[model samples]
Target: MDFHHVSVLLQESVEALNIKPDGIYADGTLGGGGHSYRICERLGNNGKLIGIDQDSNAIAAAAQRLKEYESKVIFVNDNFANIKSILDKVEMNAIDGAIMDLGVSSHQLDEGQRGFSYQHDAPLDMRMDRRNTLTAKSIVNEYSEEEIRKIIFEYGEEKWAKRIANFIVQHRQTAPIETTGELVEIIKRAVPAGARRDGPHPAKRTFQAIRIAVNDELGILETAIRDFVDVLKVGGRLAIITFHSLEDRIVKQTYNSLSSGCECPPQFPICICNKKPIVKLVNRKPRLPSEQELEENPRARSSKLRVLEKL
Candidate 1:
């Protein structure tokens, strides 16, 4: 399958980076090199851009799309959570800016074999990097009812998590939940007929929850955000685009905490905690897609872009 992904918030994210002619930048989730391509356009020959993605397919496709700028680009096939180590290996200490688009690419969802979409009846495999051992099948078949319930509720924010988890556990006991279709049917049975009549697909949230758990999406994001910021030069910017509320909340809270000048209470007579603000929020509220972009691509609706500048 062709690795294709419409970069979410394309123009906005690139502009937010405020690229300089000779500055160094990183695209932490270099899917199809959409944003990275634009960043390259704004760079002079001396400028450098590092692209990283866990999926080998993304690296290959991005290499093709960004071939013209090969002289100024470096591609790494690794998780963004290892940004610090990757940067060190490349002999770089700090970067002028970095951008992370935290959405499963269109290729992942469209490619039925990946099993990221509920509409597809493929094997229960949702590993972003095929190298990973744990998959959606393991998550569904091995996880306890309570564990599954918490994943659905906390990650997917599905109100019917308990019922859904219980249903999955009960059905998997008879036979392993081997495919997306089987899981979708279990989800349908879990949701009430009335509730199932409207809204998104019954299996959407459950599938998302399982995929997140299989890939450790949230855990990596939390760690990557801090590490990304830590490598930013003074006045360097970090822009992140999250597709889900849970991901957005983590980004927002992390940025806020880092931007906070001090942790001491207002009543404190003297400074106890010597923590100083590392970055300032570039935008008080996350930048959302415009009505025009939404019309062009419905998937862009959930995207929230948050930026911070290093102090």
Candidate 2:
């Protein structure tokens, strides 16, 4: 399948970066090179872009898409969580700006063989990086019921997590749940008919929860955000687009913490804590997709774009 993804908030995110003609920038989630392409357009010959992605497929696809600007682009097949090390390897001291689009690409969800979608009946493997040993199958068949329940409840925020976990445990006892279709069926059985009658597909939440657990998505987010900030120049900006509440919450809280100046109580007359804010929020509230963009790509409806600049 062709590596295709409708880059959410393309204009908004690039604009938020405030690209400099001679500045260095990074696209931390370079899916199909969509945002990177826009960023490159605003850069002069002296400017450079580091495009990073954990998925080799994404790297390959982006390379082809961005071939015209090869001289201005450096592609890295690695997770954005290791931004500090990645910058060191590339001999880049700091970046002028960076953007992270946290949504899974349309290609990943549409490709049945990759197992990223509940609509696809494929092996339960959701590793964004194929090199990872952990797979959704392992989590589904191996994790304790309590562990499964916790992930669904905390990550997915699915209210029927307990029942879903119970159903999975029962189904696996008879035979290992091996495919997305089988898991979907199990979820359908677990959620009450009335509850399943409305809202999202019965399996959506469980699939999201399992994918997150498999990739340790939320676990690495806060640290990665801090790392991105650490590698940013004094006035550099970081723009992140999150597709779900869990990710948005982390980004908001981390940005808030980093942008806060003092921790001393208000009662103190003189300043005791020497703590200072490292960045300032560019937008007090996240930027949502425009109505036109939403009409073109409903998948972007949940996405929220938050930007910050280093102090």
| Best by the lDDT measure | 2
- Give one digit per residue, the lDDT tens place, for model 2 in 70-99: 999999999999999999999998999999
Candidate 2 lowest-lDDT run of ten: 103-112
Residue by residue across 1-311, what tens digits does model 1's lDDT show?
47888888999999999899999999999999999999999999899999999988899999999999999999999999999999998999999999999968988899898899998899999998999999999988998999999999988889999999999999987889899999999999999999999998888898888888988999888778999999999999999999999999999999999999778999999889999999999999999999999998899989999999999
Error of 1 at 233 (Å): 0.7
User: Which parts of model 1 have CA positions greater than 4 angstroms off?
Assistant: none
Predict model 2's lDDT versus the native: 0.94
Query: Using TM-score as the measure, which candidate wins?
Result: 2
Q: What do the candidate models score in CA lDDT, each in turn?
A: 0.93, 0.94
